[model samples]
Target: MKTDQSLRTVIVTRYILPLREGGSLPALTEADDDFKYVLKFRGAGHGVKMLISELIGGELARFLGLKIPELVFANLDENFGRTEADEEIQDLLKASTGLNLAMHFLSGAINFDPSVMKVDAETASKIVWLDTFLTNIDRTFRNTNMLIWNRELWLIDFGASLYFHHSWDGWEEKAKTPFLMIKDHVLLDKATELRKIDLEFKSKITPEILSSIINLIPDDWLHWRDTELSPEEIRTVYFEFLKIRLENSEIFVKAAEDARL
Candidate 1:
């Protein structure tokens, strides 16, 4: 019942383009001033609910002190469906500097790999605290959706978040300990300064960002009537958890600042 009943017949096709020397999907786009935005089309596995989750979850995480990429919803016409990025969008991206982590273009500007990122125990602890608060289980060792832009860490790809909606009774228990935040298994623990900064600036998050997060929930994604939980209810729960985490971020931040290494 929560599905966006409005988009029942909309065919959201944004054609896939191949990047040279790369296997990932990076849509070709033109420039707009100086910002490089990804050209994303609605794909088969990308339902409205999942898109909502990506936007809401992403915005929420950004508000909670994580670095996130800017997002936009491009409205496509019949002619624009899955077509290459226009001359403008492409130019914008080409002129831009910094890392790009689009589904199509997952490249690090430098030769940085997670294996040697030097993520320490304390930074890992803060990451675990953030992930657990968000109920995000996708940032594991192999699938840590991260990128380094301008030597700063940015989190991306949050479509798999909110797994507590599934049939897991003891999911809350996972939040009790901060162990999942490991040095090497997930984040490059070497991001100690970033972690300290993240803690220092946690209070600057605005309320509009939080409200935009709650409002972006696509109606279809709420899963209102399922025997399990609905996305709406799940998001409400997440909002509360996030508020608490933001208020208590100092606890984890202090831990990182006080770490040995």
Candidate 2:
């Protein structure tokens, strides 16, 4: 969660175009700030929880010194959807006629190709550890979800990570659950120093940092029909779960190391 000083809110100025690659149907939108952003709708099939995951996952990456696009609170007016010719998009805009999440668009960025672009062992280890901590299942060889922008690798699309929140019945046990799918991570083969990376990060990510990151999530987004927990209570749950995971990161670190071998 970002501190109040770090969060920026922008109003949607124009709807540029739709990105058809993913199921969420994210749109390339222009904001009042005169900048382009990839807006993720709260009304998407994944619902507001997905936005929460995106907020946490992206901010966690930034906190760990990883490069990710800048995030903002985008305000979508009800009238913005009125001009859309597409019924589906109009419906989405209508449903999401409030605050949504947006990522600054990286113009002219290209998908990362591991064979052509070399990732050092240390960087790979850090990324792998981050993914393992978040239980991210989307950053595999098949869908990398990474881009080469300004000659640097940037992580994107974290709506699929932090999946434990989808089902809170046994979330405590699930937080410590082994991420078996990490074996297929795009950087797993190059992440040879998982223990070292884990050691470097374990202490840096304090409970305070986790709480701040979780705090960045808007209250409205945390309210879900599936559970009766209030927004603040839900934030506390995330903080506790992540703190427990940090304490138990050795398990995940060892798993990543074994997989690399």
Candidate 3:
């Protein structure tokens, strides 16, 4: 885990255009740092939890040494939305007048196609393990949220990964349950060695590392919802959930192995 650098905060200087690819309507934004990012708003229809999921999933991928774009906090000023002619985008910008999540945009990167690009067994296993561990239901052949940048595969758009957060009523039980969706993962066939990858990742992802990553989320994003749980308490829930998943990863690993057969 690279703990040397934390997520940087950049003010939104310009909202260039909308990507129109995903339902949330992420935009091509130029931040104060002069870098363009795919900005995910806090007030989008998907809500703040989606941002939380993106941050957690992307950071976890980074921790596992996978290729993921750098995530930053994009600060939106009140007048930032005035220039957008689209009413829907104007409304979206108006609602998201504060901190939002931004993924550093990779220019000229092509969508990953399995037939054209080959991934090694170990890399495939690690990616499959990650998607399975997080219960990410988005990375199938039809909608593989992956990119080929600089001749390497990069994981992107994790807002749909942690579906358990949408309804936390049975989160504990669901955390331990098998992620049956691994069978549809784009990299499942190439993940021939699950047990070895699981064991290696288990040792690397300690409780401390998880806590540190979870702590990176801003307080507003964590506590803004009308829930009784304080920001710290909510973070604790995530930590515990992840720890339990890591401890019982064998259940998920076996499921992935079975899916491979």
Candidate 4:
């Protein structure tokens, strides 16, 4: 499980500002390591589940050779953010006093604008294939959720992926179903190598790799709610779900290619 270096831990030093573009209320915060991060709070409206999705989705994208910011576990102490003038921000800080999810902040990155720049077929194909595997639904034109960092495309904001876990029911059916929403994906038309990329990517994300990534999910997040399943049981459910989905990737791979053509 690569338990030795699961994720680098950082302590939140200060909340620099709030980023309202995302519904999860991620903030620009400085960590004790002296690096800035876009911190996703467990106290946010989407709750800890969103953080879980963010962790898994970001790691999966990186595993597939996609460009994504480095994710970290940011620890928030209750004493932090006590002097913030905004009551809302103060409340949020108080509630998220434990481990939160964050990614290295790209200081000068700009939001991706398709009309201004274009992506190549293989890069687009890999992205489409990855999103389809995770059932990410937020990559449409309205909100690309992509950024241009150092003139390269970088993926971000994966809290919108893995939607099936919201209800935790019928995951097997959802895993096997075609993610028809790929039609709205910004890269759909440019993803010309889904067939070839599918073969390449499926070989990369094996059960061992999946287990290592799944092991990164924090126990507190898994048992956040009063669900009947223990944290370990919940983790097993996610493992099984992804295993089924990866085994059935061809369904969505074809669905995406069909949508593209």
TM-score of 3: 0.96
Candidate 4: pairs in clash? none
Error of 3 at 192 (Å): 0.7
Between candidates 3 and 4, the TM-score winner: 4
Q: Arrange candidates by lDDT, descending.
A: 4, 3, 2, 1
Residue 80 C-alpha lDDT in model 1: 47
TM-scores of the candidates are 0.52, 0.96, 0.96, 0.97
lDDT over C-alpha atoms for residue 209 of model 1: 48
lDDT of each: 0.47, 0.89, 0.90, 0.91
**Per-residue lDDT for 1-261 in model 1, tens only?**
122211112222333443332112335443323333444323313333345556666666666666676655543443443234566434433332222222223344343357766555545555554554454556756667777667766676666555554433544443232323333235434444545545544655444445456655554445544446666666666455455555555554444334324
lDDT of 1: 0.47
Please identify model 1 stretches exceeding 4 Å from their true place: 1-35, 39-42, 82-112, 120-123, 166-185, 188-212, 218-261
Q: Per-residue CA lDDT of candidate 2, range 1-261, in tens?
A: 445325699999999999988789999999999999999999997888888888998998898999999999999988886978999989999999899999999999999998799999989988999998998898887889999999999999899888898888888887787788899999999998888888899979877788778888888787789999999889988988888888889788888877778
Error of 3 at 138 (Å): 0.8
lDDT of 3 by residue, 13-112 (tens): 9989988988899999998889999999998967789999999999999989999999999999999889789999999999999999999999999999
Candidate 2 residues lying further than 4 Å off, grouped into runs, are 1-5
Pairwise lDDT winner, candidates 1 and 2? 2
Candidate 4: Cα lDDT at 256: 92
Q: What is the Cα root-mean-square deviation between model 1 and the actual structure?
A: 9.4
The 10 consecutive residues of candidate 2 with the worst lDDT sum are 1-10
| Candidate ordering by TM-score (highest first) | 4, 2, 3, 1
